[model samples]
Target: MLSYGKADVRNASHLALSNPLSKCAESTSSDLATSKLHTIIDALAFRARSIPDQTAFVHLVDGEVIEQAITYRELWSRSQSIAAYLKAFEPNGKRAVLLLDTGIEYVSWLFGLFHAGMTIIPAFPPIGSRGLSRLALICADAQPDIIVADARFSNARERLNDLLPSAMPQPYWVETTIPTGGPDCTGVGPARDDIALLQYTSGSTSTPKGVILTHANLVSNCENASLWMGDIRGRVGCTWLPPYHDMGLMGGILQPVYDGFSTLLINPGHFIQKPFRWLSAVSRYKVTVTIAPNFALDLCTDGISDAERSTLDLRHVRAIYCGAEPVRSRTIERFTDRFAAAGLDPATIGPCYGLAEATVLVAGKPVDKPFVSFHVDREMLSRGTIQVVDENAPGACPLVSSGRPAAGVEILIVDPLELQIVPEGRIGEIWVKGDNVGTGYWRNAVASSETFGGTLPEVDGQFLRTGDLGALLEGELIVTGRLKDLIIVSGRNLYPQDIELTVEETDSRIRPNGCVAVALDDGERERIAIVAEIKRSEKLDDVAQELLRRSLTAAIVAAYGVKPEHIHLATPGTIPRTTSGKVRRRAVRDALLAGNFAQYGGRTRAPVPADRSAS
Candidate 1:
């Protein structure tokens, strides 16, 4: 069995309400009051009115700072002008596509559309030429009457127009000041059921579906989330999540604005190229709330230099929500330890769970409690049993619970086929139905009917079927794996993460963090292939490869009674990841299929020599 360090003498009990600092509420009064229309608009206008002179947005582009802050009265007046301008351009509540990155213009553009009662299609600005082509097709499908773009997107707009000049309508660029001669508009919008924004999903190629979020849906989610976060309105937050994403759009912008909170919004490119800037902004602004995925923590810890650490102080960060991907226990521990020297609170790193379908949040632990991890057997876990094991067991990886469902939401584990509820601690497909559940996708009836509609069973008068596989243990939701991510091999199921984790812990020679487990097909038999990243300059060549193969074989044989087809060693950081930090395993598998490892700077060497193989 593999060895492990002893557990520290820290407390892991359930957070008590008696602890004034604890934010977890076992029994919250489920009074999710609807946010009055007048109150919400008044609140937004109030911020501008109160701080009309203060800065609303500060842009640091190409090493230059451009500031724009409008008072409430000025913002309202400008919005009226823009609304009039837009109505003159396209009368009625026609659609307006926004092709701009996150900036002051983005806000004005949205406010103008809202003011005009027109649908807003938020397109990612940095999508460039290729993304623009895809976006044009999406627009064709959306068939928007008009488009609003900034100067930066002129090239993309021209390219899209060139590609489909006849089909695609002409777009109006918002370059000069807000317009003045259009229909006069004011007051609360259409009914709460009217669509406010059409958020497009990621899979735009095979099936492009935009979620239709109503005013009530958006308002309810923000109000509920505000209740969850203790509605600390007026607090300052720093965000770098892309505006196109649900998390960035709803959580980063809508939630803050609805609750009257001030936030420092940064673009995604800034975060990807230099993650330190994200942290620097938080430290500089003394931000109290921030959210990011798991890989962001890994990048921050791996990329930050020692010299940069001296200027960092994270003491003011009260709560950090981590979701969008699997929450790695080891990664968080290392990150917390690294920042602890700068007075960062380990308890503030709140591991959360949610998805786009559920409006971005399902459950999360209290901010005051440090993360909790359950050590379970990897083999038994794949069999739908969460077999608790000793923390130091050789094949044990701690599974983090995403806490209980939020107030006004109910989540349950059920059999995907049978539709019957599963017992506690037994893995099953997760099914949820609540006010937080979103309306069906835009125009894709087949997909919407199959996934979000009532094809699945109902729970307490609400439709269900989450597509996630998890179990409930001790009254908390423990997501084990994805129902669709299981790989069928030789009449058995193998989880890629289980094998990848095994490889990382089996041998010390392999790059600890850069390893992936993928299945390889030889046109006859399918076998598992372990692609591990080796530290450069670790010369052994074939010897290192053989050692990895043998070590992985022993570990698998002892744990799952299986052997891999091959063990390939690669350079560190070769695996591609999504914008939100999820490892793009299919990309690596495709590279292996096309035999492009060598071209990709990977070592094309054979396995280790027989004699050099590990015992």
Candidate 2:
């Protein structure tokens, strides 16, 4: 049995006691309290010893008033037991796929896998044949040694077996829900450099790639987040992001543990069905910190009713981090304005930027200040220059700041082709170098080298190419758009996100957040094509279609001084989206090229005036 004395437990509970103030307080010590610790296992062990009885996690089920809580002591004991059981299968140093539903149960298994020294591959539990097919592809690529799941999902073995190729080896199955007892082996875990997680990207633009994150990467990221956000040691955090995503896993689940904060977690489904439940939980639990993507903020702004807003008291919330997608300034403004009556502070809104390659957080706004944006000349922005102008200036576009880089992180805006640093206020690819950055992609050396091997002429080592276009103003970072999704028309650069947003804003008949803009090479100049989903309503005749198309075209021309070559209006859910709700622009483009939306009354490309130009 591993030794665990009373003194160790006492010391462990005090791990995060370095900061006694709330998140808003000015904390000079911007270092992770557990920076000296090598791996997350060490931190968890310390917590078990120090604050054994402190609630570690709370799960609020849909329609259930009573929330389930798990204390540190109980969590450690169960995880150790499960780890001991897993050791029988000799899973050490092997990748183990976790296909379980979200809850305290999944949390326990996650720690158990860590304790057993297994590389974890977190995947969503497959729901249907399509989901199973995706899982099968992941299984083929990962080639995991074992599959750990709830008893209810063990039957997935048969379905996966049928879908997988005959040559691949079948993985061992282990059900974590059942009670198991075995020899104690609590102290055994991975080293600092050992792989901790295989976080799969959402693949919005291409095939999914598994990002290899080490224990040190995770610990460093959590430390950087804590330091960047001030002292949130004892703050209550709430989240409904899926456990499989990087932001959800690192920022939501693991960060709280590293800081000794109690977290209230609701299922993503519940939050989608009723966004108010997320707010309600925060009010009831007095949650001080929370995080979500841009769409979730838009959803709550539009979905929550006046009566629902009246019940919410969000004054206790010190930070509401918005990330995982392009942060829209209008969404933040609308949400803050709409919720101010419920005591929501505009300062609490944090528009941050991050990706899986860097663990989770690269930069975030300080908790003490309100979110800010810069209004720049849109034409100059298209030409890679960020010229600050008055909001009412002609052709001005508001670009939200993604804050400064976290401690121990270095960011550079470099030309994508030449790999040379861009001038200040000039948009370019964002490259990051930090200890928190992951080693590389799993088993994919080409992508690993291409993305993680970026180097500058004056830099000593490789930097992570974020593939995101942004510019540095003064000291803050302003993300513009994705490099691959940049649309150049008549010598002017335009972001598809900007065009899609304009389309969504054009007509009430168009569904919110379901539009995609792509550029097609029409022999000479690039032509802009858009595929948008219309809200399901009374059938629209030819007249309605013509009016809708004209309104959309007029909106595009008004917002972006260029006419689109084609616009297609399809039924709801016709446009494809990644699992994390990011619009798959490339996939939509492919479908458009393949005539995949013919059943949804697809429209053909209309010739644009050759003399048209982006103002």
Candidate 3:
């Protein structure tokens, strides 16, 4: 158990000072800002050649253990075969959509794509049928030359065929089951300026946007990430995040590969079912480096047993990157304290910052560096002023600094409307300009133009406008809030508007215009929840609740399919409303938690008359 009073003071004190690990105010010169494409694949191939019989990856399945160790010679030979096999389809072998679920095959194909001189578009297999369909739609729109998939997702090709009326004469499916060496086909890769990977954000909207990343962009981010993660070669990096997410695909897996290190991966579903297995894996594998969103740590702290904890050791983990969502101080403390006895180092918990648009990392600090924070007035924070204060000061909420920008990246805090750079300690939208920044979104010219076509008046350059709200406190980035209605639950972005629209369509009693979708932050944790008004009668309420629950649940499961943390039912017209008649979600949440819902006594609440014509 944590003493909030004590933790609050300590946390607040840390926030009042500058981050020790923050980089100097002086920026790197243009001449010093540099990158090399194909470093990761090249490094892996180099290692495979230098040490032919090294363990490359270890995979564990139900009661079965399998390890694939490749010598440099073997990896090179197989990559050539895989590349040759990949060239059987496209005349130019320009690009391929890799749908292989996580496995050795996936890793090999990823490596082979580099050797084959083909761009890779990775999609998660079990991202729900709807997510898969959405991916196919985007892939069709992008018009990749070939589709590489495991046998299980062969149906996706059919789905792709249905979604894209004019896909092509025939899209090729490179089965990863065959361990044929990577294709030996030789073709000059597109310029570093050309697209290397296309990653789609979770299907937040009907038509998902694809983040277009160039080879130079990804390679640069990976190299910077390696520096932030320290020299990881010859170390085992453990991971359980899904291989499709930017943080997982690029940061978790690719960073290790970039550093020429072997990785131990477990499927996310298996870990979710048994969160403790994550710790078990770390101890069993002696993983020296790993990364996870804050929630995974929360799960381990909440569910791991002291008895089981005693049997494990996480000391080898030099740094665990906490990102992919808002970094909360409570989460960090809880995890550190809980695992302290298990040889987990509290200082090794590195709270970093990143986004999909940045190819994952925008800012990070060394793990051994003490966490930094700043306490400012929430009201002042919203007004764009970052006034640091004592932790015990009334109305002071501590904000954790996401450290300074990564080595080569430049971050600016600017007013959203004016594009004027805000002064130090003033909150503003985060604008990032760097080689690691993506080219633009796939087929989303409108969005791309809006996000990347802006010039910061103070910075005097183009920057990718991040919708996130933050500030620069003594040169370190302190993210405070988001300007959008994106709900982040357990490190995944959940759009409330999407869920509200889903519910409104199917539930008749859900006053379409009277629903408020908001995340409830109950001091300790946050979750996506909603409140909606219905008829004010016991029978009506019961009927509405059950129908709304079942219908909304099924609809959400079918569509985006993530289960919201909770749902709330309110009496018709009782939910808080704005002057213009818009539902006030924050107010509704305040009222619901306060138990201020009104009792129903109107006509809608009265029982129907039962008497027939005078008997």
Candidate 4:
């Protein structure tokens, strides 16, 4: 395998800086034309007319081979066909839902709905039992007029209809297998402020909220994201992320068209089954920029074999944005160290912060420098203060900075209870005010006001109250944890992600990045309880369970001096996760409260002495 040294990292950083923000520096004439183009419909038409031959999208089959590819002209023609068919229905401000999986037709329907002046609702195809129920709930909420579904998913449709039961009127279904051989679209498109899409929340915290995204909001978000991404023109992007989610939708699908670049889309299941396919595609296709959550980075580090590493050439790759979950410094460091021999630049691992309500990009670290982090006192961090400490010091916690605010986005750290701005460098709720902020949730004015209509002590304009907890240090944003996910134990704030990371690091039998920490109440005080998923090979026995619990409790007690309530060992995939693959701690708590959990009752063993050098 090829190995890259310090020179490689420096060269990659310099290369990224050389073309900084070239996309934003368009010619004045083109900029004026772009300014006049408000909706994505306008952007698509512009791309098709100006760069008809430019490759627009490539869908990787099995995450390895390019099975579907489309150019801007072809995409426009196919979408026009769908639009003309839809126009025949006279869709007067109708809400249309997309139930097809991630592929070329998905993109066609996306633009076709916009071209037909219908508000788009992007929903993941109903897959599992939960998928059916969730999709039913989404349909019930939106009450969409038209549903664009894959003809191949007839069985799933039957299950969905059975679940929803016909008490509700059936929506007009548009099967994807049907051919629409019609003329080009002739109707004028929607205005900038008109409703364009309904981006539902991931339901990670609660029921998924239907966020109303206007065309103007999306255009603003794309422009600001370009300024954050910098030099994205001519850069090829790729992702195995699902297209319905916020990061995948904005970064993978929309951002490419907005910046006039091509992107490769991979099925997420194939990547999960074989992560090597992701990097293999990047190596084979010369992908320059890609996006994935932090777990993907860890999977590549541990799952990819040395033989696989020998096959990759990553020097052409400049940035791999890691987000959508708590960004762990250990994971980033391990991935960089593991791939340095494959010409991977350590500085190319960019830790970012974003949310769906804010349109997927709020802050991203500059790509011109090496990644940086702050080692702070963990106990003090929980108490709401930033206290830098030595890396080798006791109670030292390393936190990576998520970078400064993106262009045109204003951030304020507001104390959630008082609704007043907190002082700089203090943990508080992140309130965002920007053009990218969606108008509000659909048909839910109370939640819209509670989350989107944020008002500060002296601020005049409305701000989107992001439920994330973070702090500003040295002008960079450092996200700590979710406000709802925080577990208070005897007055100390314990972040579940921090504990979950530690639990995974404690043993090899425990699955990496598959632990959930929740607060257990003993009436008088709340103690930390862990639900850890053991590796499938490590089957659960009486002795194994006892030793695992003892080791976990010992490590945690040494680190935080708190005994665990109980450690529940789950088999692989037993723990519940959100649609976007984040752990649902609230759901775990709900299950525990409902007594829907396994119990391992044995004689309580005395805790062993903790390792002096535990993480």
Candidate 5:
């Protein structure tokens, strides 16, 4: 059980601060900072010749059973053949949308598109007929010259045509899958500034925007992450994150190829269905590094049984990079404690911060290092400043550090209202400048300029406005909340995450990661509204719900000193999340205002109808 406690892991610098296997910072053989290679594909070509037989990727059929182990030469050759096939359509510098499932085909075709010098658009195929609108939106915006798919999705044209923008021409369709040991063909050599691919944001906040990453940007991010995380080669990494996302693409897929190493791949479905398979893979393949969202840590810690846990060894996992959501301090401590019997290192849980705009990693540390944290005066933290305090201090809230900036990356904490750099330990919007930062959104010049062209009056340089609220304490980045999601009551800035965490700890039936706290308009007054999901395993009766609602309201008041105007308890899976598994708090607020929760849950007393005056 996840217990909300006052204590947590602090600055445990006693843990190994360095990876002995690695060389000094930025000097590793695969370090692109000091290499002549401009693009990742260039590095791949070199490795393909020097170490042709090296294992590049291993695919898990069911997250544990190995389905295929693709070699460097095999992948290189496959990319070449696919590139040759693409050339028949004059694919040079044209957009090709890859709508494929998670497998070797996805990886092969991804590299193939780059080799063909075609601007790649990485997107997931629709599930049945669902999600076509979003795909159509992306496709319409991209105006792809060709659509590449696996053989199974050959009928995409019929379905996509109806959804595509009327003015755009129908994209040419190519349905082909590569076979092993295909005859090779020559591929194009791309320059550093050549457009490599476009990765669309998961759209947790608004419409999905494609972040344009060039050949240089992709290569730089790989090396920058490697510099911060220590050596990349001679170590096994694994990932079950959707391969198309920035984290999985750069960290899981491209990093190994850049360093001439092998990484295990698991279908996201497999990991979700059987969380134990992750630990099993770590034990079986001796995986040293892996990446996942914050929820996966709690899922694995609770989902794995003592009997099942005993059959595995996790000593090999050096770092489990946890990000893509608010990194809970309790989760890191709970996971480390639960697997202590199985040789899980306390330092293995590394909480990092990133976004699609920055090409995934903005700040991370050596995986071998422990995640640092600070217990601050909760009220001061909300008022755009930090006051470090003892854990036992009254009204103390613990915030986990998401490490420091990567090599060649500069982070500036700027006051959004003042338009100046805030003093350290003061909360502000996180602004970033680095090679890894994408150029701009695809074809959206206005949005691009606002996001990527920010500059301070005193400091001159291009900075990407991260739209995230965070502070720097002793040089470590402590992300507090989203700027747009900051909720204020009585002039106090209350982060929704803080309020939501308090609600989860209020009752045993409240699902972990199933609660969202938002501010709703109540006439001229703004009110705090909490929508939480009850676990399906628990019985939900009117009598039980009434008791639970009281507890939830009381808990919110006790924690935040503000009364929740309404508490609605819903069935499991009532809340919405993005494709990347981030809770859509904005969507939750929208649903609440739209009266969507009325159909899903039993609320406390007669619920207050949302005041549509603010809506």
Candidate 6:
């Protein structure tokens, strides 16, 4: 049974008399253990009754300092009050877009929507014209009934007025700070099958799609994550991930609340400005679990100085979940080697894999075990085979395992075209099925049927086509790359990430995670094209730029046996990326074909072999 402090029990009894709808008597520790808590609202109510004063979330600034905190009772109260305000707009079972910046207000509004039985459509506020246009696209797609924003963003009202069409149904705008006090509001908890969130894809590979996630899906995924990560009740978590993304919303924000733990939250901008604060917060708060993408691990390793590293103590951290993008083995090695002195355990590094369609965690390694990788022949991997080899062997490529499927989740490697399960070690499309898997895309029947209704011959259950290519070796999932992103050259399959990583490693001027490899059809055959982002330094002469181009082309040929016909080097931040940080290779390819970067004139054809080494 769950444990509660004596003082909290007393406070719950008093609070229950004031608000009878909370049903505090029915949410005892025994009931919490037996009932699944269908919706997040129920979970929050349970916690409020059991641990009224327990810290739910804490926002931190620089130097690992807390700027604000919210207790379980306070969170419940504020969310209920906000829910009452939203109900006046008749938002019951309707979609509400969130435009507020990340903070306590954002958290409160999210829960408030849940309490009011409204579907949530979380989005980032626009920064400029480009951002406003993107927001326009999302609003057009979602067609929300209401929009919730913080009044602090002075430009939000103007931006919304400009982007939203006059003829379209304008959503009712509600400011979070403005209190609309009325009679005591009663919470009508959402049913298990009700739509809880309409999470939009990050649009890295294609246009964004609204994924329909039900309350059951969210609850199931959180329960599975808790089981996989061990008992997290009352544990601490830290994150600097954006609240709009799945990794942040589900893992960083919701999971802690569902598991009855306090989270140390930091703004993503703050962490990017100073990566050391992430680790320092873990040390200061004894954060047991945190999640980040692969690039964040690299940032912590490269951005932190030895002087700062010496002051950290991360022994209390049990798991550092790495996902959202491709996990690099070298990044993990570098981080562990650099921070071993700071009490970081090698086993604490957990490589995880999931998507917005799965409500976050689909698979993750156990926190007690060290990360695992397989060294396979590079040529074999390119040919769609996983042949294990020695690390020092010629053309050896290291493939990191994304761990086994989470509890109650099943993963199948199936041929994309045939929809049949493939051999265990053969690379194929990843198919997943579990209670955590979302039902379908919002209002998109064709895509929903094609993606969420995938069937396996002679199998009884439906599976989600993950669009990712991977193989299961010894029961561990090794994600290779996206099925659509594979570059086919001379009958060999080369992953774009492999080529991009090689290009970045070949030159110090090339920005890490800023290169994209794409295949262009030359009417008869598909030719390779690479768009690499370089750090803007001194202007290079035409001759020097040509020499740099040839060097990169020759390196690609030597590494993958495929020479890129066109190589375009652009300034930093030119390559488009999703909010979660996955490179938008398709968008970059389109921009390159359209000659978008011709003004900077970084494009160059490969020089002859004789002039390749001339610098």
TM-score of 5: 0.92
**Backbone atom clashes (below 3 Å) for every candidate:** 7, 6, 22, 1, 0, 0
lDDT tens per residue, model 5, 413-516: 99988879999999999999999899999999999999999898768688999999999889899999899888888888999999988888778688888888
lDDT of 1 by residue, 26-137 (tens): 2222222332353233344555554454334333332112223333344455556677766555534566677777755566566666666676777666364547665776
Ordered list by TM-score, greatest first: 5, 2, 4, 6, 1, 3
* Candidate 5 worst ten-residue window by lDDT: 1-10
| Candidate 3 runs further than 4 Å off | 1-39, 63-73, 91-93, 126-128, 166-170, 179-183, 188-191, 458-460, 486-615
143 in model 4: Cα distance from truth in Å?
Answer: 0.6
Off by over 4 Å in 5: 1-35, 178-187, 598-608, 612-615
Off by over 4 Å in 4: 1-35, 165-167, 522-524, 598-615
Q: Each prediction's TM-score against the native?
A: 0.81, 0.91, 0.73, 0.91, 0.92, 0.91
Give Cα-based local distance difference scores for all models: 0.64, 0.80, 0.64, 0.79, 0.79, 0.80
Candidate 1 lDDT at 576 equals 57
Residue 422 shift from truth in candidate 3, angstroms: 0.3
Instruction: Pick the lDDT winner.
Output: 2
Query: How well does candidate 1 score on lDDT at residue 112?
Result: 61
Give candidate 6 regions above 4 Å deviation. 1-31, 61-66, 152-154, 536-544, 598-615
TM-score of 6: 0.91
Write down the worst ten-residue block by lDDT for model 1.
Answer: 15-24
Candidate 4 minimal-lDDT segment of 10 residues: 1-10
